[model samples]
Target: MSTPQPQTHQQAAPAPNWQSAPGTSYTSPIPITRTHLGHALTSEWTKIKSVRSTMWTLGVFLLLVVGIGLLVAANTDSNDYADVPYTIPAFFGLILGQICLITLGVLVVSSEYGTGMIRTTFTASPQRHRVLTAKLLIFFVVAFVVSAFAIGFVGLITSGMHGGASDNKWGGTVLMGALYVSLLGVLALAVGSMLRHSAGAITAMLGLVLVPAILPAFLMMSESLRTLGEKMTEYNAPNALAKIFELDSENGGGGSQLVLLVGVTAAAIAGAYALLERRDV
Candidate 1:
């Protein structure tokens, strides 16, 4: 061997330790927080409040409720309420205002579908059921609160204008009416979710709210059909609210109307949940 065979040098190979060892767990550098119903509620609240449809719908609701309420109160003499509950005047505005609530309810979910925002909503929160539940809760609460305030304000004004004719039942009647309308709005949301289209859902709800009331009038030609139509008229949305207001013919009373609405709304919500779970975004 050449005496000074160029000093050979060998470097040790690096150990294969960069990979995780067997049975060892790896932690991510990123942090994640668990989401809950509260988050969904917040998201829904923000979405509902930020939309122009909400403003326009609710604005018209307020105008109709307050404007018509005052007008009715101003035109009628307090003595006229001797036989009727003072809260009856609020009915004029609430009947029309309910349309606004229904429109807003449809827009709440249908608008998102129309704009394709639902895809992002599901992407962010894959638990579709939770998202839908949150929407229902938030919308019901908002609708109830706004309606209550409007009805209360109208009742107060009517009472002041006709104190002697006012009845203590005004509170209960107003609360019941508010509940009825809120349920209708919730039903509208469910329909919107099921249809996934704004115009279609709105039309469906309009029919739900209106057709039952009018159909009976035309069906009076047949006795058997008239009976069914009469029942529909008695239990229809407007008549239900009117019963709560103590203005309509007292067939089933407000209690029966509330029960019917609750049943219908519950069924719709269940169907909505089922459809939402099975369908693709």
Candidate 2:
């Protein structure tokens, strides 16, 4: 009777299949696309244009440049241009307005870090160098364009009103000044990337831009350091821009300033890339 109870046979459970069957394939729901530098450029452009900091900084910059420039041009007498270049007044405004570009440049990269958006940026684009490059390129182009326009406008108005013989050099000087500002901005961007903090990066850039000019004045107390101080004052950012405007007669040509700025910017950019690759987001 016990032996007759049920067939006493149980079907064996099928063994689990860990591998896909031959000739079968699995498809993912997410679509994947290859990313390139253009994608990063577009992303950075969108970021720079969308942010309020960019608008506010650039707006103030334009106001300082154009407004002060016009005021200077209005106050100048035609006789004043006999000894001075028509474009000289533009420097009065540009020296102050250049700070705005430095601020914007720091904000461009540091703001993202401050807000934790950089993590998302890196997530979207894993190539840190590409992201940095895109940021530098976009910021430089925008800054240069805006600066060129502002400086050129001032030069045009002043030249028209004063009608100087050296008006021919206005265009070249404006171009050089704009490039100088743009390179300073790129340097700021590099510093921001290296620091990853808006306030710290901005402070560092301000020191970089202004300290050389100021420190040399105090250092003149020491006769031993007077030469060094003079050199710093001569080669500082303001002096560089002044040289371009033909305001600093003691300094050498703008070519040296441009070369120095380019070399410094290149070094900062290289350091930024190196630090970014080595650090965690």
Candidate 1: segments with Cα more than 4 A from true spot: 1-17, 20-29
Q: Write the per-residue lDDT of candidate 1 for residues 1-281, one digit (tens) a residue.
A: 55766877999998887878899998889998899999999999999999989889989998999899999999999777876677777889998999999999888899989989999999999999999999999999999999988898988888888765645467887788789888999999999999999999999999988899888888887987888887888888878888888777557457898998899999999999999999998
Give the Cα-based TM-score of candidate 1 against the true structure. Answer: 0.90
Task: Please estimate how well model 1 matches the true structure, expressed as its whole-model Cα lDDT.
Answer: 0.89
* Alpha carbon deviation, residue 16, candidate 2 (Å): 12
Q: TM-score for all predictions? A: 0.90, 0.88
lDDT of 2 by residue, 76-146 (tens): 87877664566777787889999999999999999988889999999999999999999999999999999
Clash pairs, model 2 backbone: none
Per-model RMSD to reference: 3.8, 3.4
